[model samples]
Each structure stands twice: as structure tokens, then as C-alpha cells.
Target: MAIGPSAVERWLDLSTEELRAQVKQLVAARLPGDHSVWQAIRRHPALVPRIRGVLSGLAASAAGSKDEAMQKVWISKARSALDQEYVAPVKAARKPVVKEEPVPEPEPVIELKEPEPQQKQPHKAIPTMLFQEPS
Candidate 1:
């Protein structure tokens, strides 16, 4: 029988151990976002680490799976949940940098310019063929 969103509570209703197993199987079937579990996960994000564990196991299994690319998609989905579905981890606040006056840039040490062309001069060879007599 096809399960609907309204029926999700029935699926989710189980003992703690049973629920974990069911959630594992559900995540294995598809992305957590594709199911109502995402809503529950949003409500109780402590489940993220467990989900991540399952995803990591899935990633390892993907190595031997014929559809490795598809398995990578699951990994992407897991990362997306961590990045987008929840608040980011707290980062250490950076200390304010002391303001220092800007120093003027220094002039270049070397300058380059195109070489000037030299004027053509007549060569003093063979007296410029002057007084050309019989060869």
C-alpha cells in the first residue's frame, strides 16, 4: 500500500530501537528530505549525527555498488541537510585588527623604454664605386 504524509506518524510510531532501524531503512531508500523524516529531523536535529553515520556507511558501500554515482547523490543530500536544513556551527569570533595608516606605494626601481632607431649612414667601403673603369 502507498504511504501518504498523513500515514507518516504510523510509520514513525515505534520503540526507540525500532524507530532508529526504520529511519535507517528510510534514509537508505532515499534522501531524508524526500520523506517526512526531514520534518522530524528538523524538530529533533540530534538525529543528524545518526543520519550522518548511516550516510557515511552508505558512502562506503557505494564504492562497491554498481550505481556509485547514485550513492554519491545520497551523500550530497546528507551534506545538504547539514548545511541548509539546520543552523551552522558556532565559529570563533575574530579579534578586531588594529587600524594602521596606509603607507604610500614605492616607485619602481627600474624603468624600461624602447630603444631609439639608429640613422642609416653611408659605409666608406671601396670609395663608393667612384671612377668605375673597365672591369
Candidate 2:
């Protein structure tokens, strides 16, 4: 239920001399990224080291505090501000074009031949009707 200053408010509260000292400490620690406090640094995101130093100092002070949960909340907010600061945006990626190849047609494997139909011959008449009677 404790209310406190925001990260921007805390940063803005620092005296010029204190900010300069923090920036120097960051440089001494060989922290990467921009340490300058200029507005231009906000656009391209180069001021990480400077603010990170401030966060470190804040953590040291909060370590001995009675309210550990509140201190963690404050630190989380400050970190969130650092992470969400102005920076160069990522560009959309484009898909690469793929070339198509022509496929060859396959030849037939098995061959079959069919026989032609033949006409049927007529049957010869029998001579049974010409038999002579024995009188």
C-alpha cells in the first residue's frame, strides 16, 4: 500500500552532480551502451549504462529497507522503464523467391495384344432320309 516516486521522477530528482558521478561510475565499470543523458540517446537507445548505474544504487539502498516486497516492485518498475525506452525498431522480414524445375514424363512399361474374332462354318445335312425299306 506504499506509494513512491516513479523511475522518471527518481531520475529527474537527481542533482546534476550526482548524475555525472553515476555516469562516470558506469563508464569506469565498462558498462556497454550510451552513457550520455542527451535526448538523442533516447531515440537510438544509448543511455543504458547511465540508468543502469542508478538502478544499482537504488538496489543497494533498498536492500536494507523494511519493505522487501515494495522495494522489489520499485525495482521492477525502473527496470521496465529501462527496457521500454525509445530505440530503433525492427524491420519486417521478406520471404525469398524459389525457382521451379520442369519434370520429365515417364514411358509405359507393359504392352498387350488382343486376337480377332473368327466366323463359324455351317454343318453338312445327313443322308438318313434316303434309306431303302426291306419289303
Candidate 3:
């Protein structure tokens, strides 16, 4: 349905939070204590504009009537619009984290060796005897 000029002006004038507050107020007024629709809207809040559109359509069609039946109808329409506009896709669950085991340290090594013995030589004294015999 085409949005009215006043609706466009109202939407442009209000902040996002204000618009949401207005939607929440309307939902609360129509369906008091019903939180499923509001919870869905809170989770995927981008659907606020769609909910506003549905509300505006209801207002335009009803022309400022405060009838209980009509308000119930508006609430029903708003819930359905929220459901259709913000259906979330199924997401995969996250995996658990794993811890690694600590490694053991190596042992120190040591070695020992014995020293070697030295050899001795003997001297000859026959030079004096040879000289005396020659004399």
C-alpha cells in the first residue's frame, strides 16, 4: 500500500528510537503483555519500518477509530508483518576450543677419562775406556 504524505513526514521527523518507541507503544496498547512480537522486533530491529507500514495501513483503513476489534486486527497484522519481514536463517553452532599437553625437558650428560704414562731412555759411558786403551 502507498504511504500517505503525513506518514512520510512523521517518519522523516522522528529518530529511530522514537519511531521504535511509538511502535512499542502501539503494540502495547493493542496487545498488552504480549512480548513475542516485541521480542522478535527487538532481535531484528530492521523490521521496524515494516511494522510501521502495517500500523499506518491499519490507521489509514480504520480512519482514527478506537474500536477494540479493529485494534486486535491491527495487532494481528503487525505480528504477521514482523514474522514475514524478519525470518532468520538457521546458524551453525560454534566449536569448542582444545588445549595442548606440555612437553618434558631433556636430562644433562657428563663424561670422564684417565691420563697416559711417559717413557725413559738410558745413557752409555764407554768413551773413557776406549781413550785409555789407545794411550
Q: Which candidate is the best by TM-score?
A: 1
After TM-score superposition, the amount by which residue 95's alpha carbon in candidate 1 deviates from its true location, in angstroms, is: 43
Better candidate number, 1 or 3, judged by lDDT = 1
Q: For candidate 3, lDDT tens digit of each residue in 1-135?
A: 123223433544566566655664555455432344444453545546656665665556556566756665767756664555334557989988778788786876766666566666566665655445555
lDDT of 2 by residue, 27-103 (tens): 23432233333223344343456666666666676686797566556556555545655655579799788787878
- What TM-score would you give candidate 1 relative to the actual structure? 0.41
Q: Give the lDDT of residue 95 in candidate 3.
A: 85
The lDDT ranking, best first, is 1, 3, 2
Pairs in steric clash, model 3:
none
lDDT, candidate 1, residue 47? 53
Q: Using TM-score as the measure, what is the rank order of every candidate, best first?
A: 1, 2, 3
What is each predicted model's overall lDDT from 0 to 1? Answer: 0.60, 0.51, 0.54
TM-score against truth, every candidate: 0.41, 0.33, 0.27
Give the C-alpha miss distance for residue 40 in model 2, angstroms: 8.2
User: Top lDDT: which candidate number?
Assistant: 1
Worst 10 residues of 1 by lDDT: 1-10
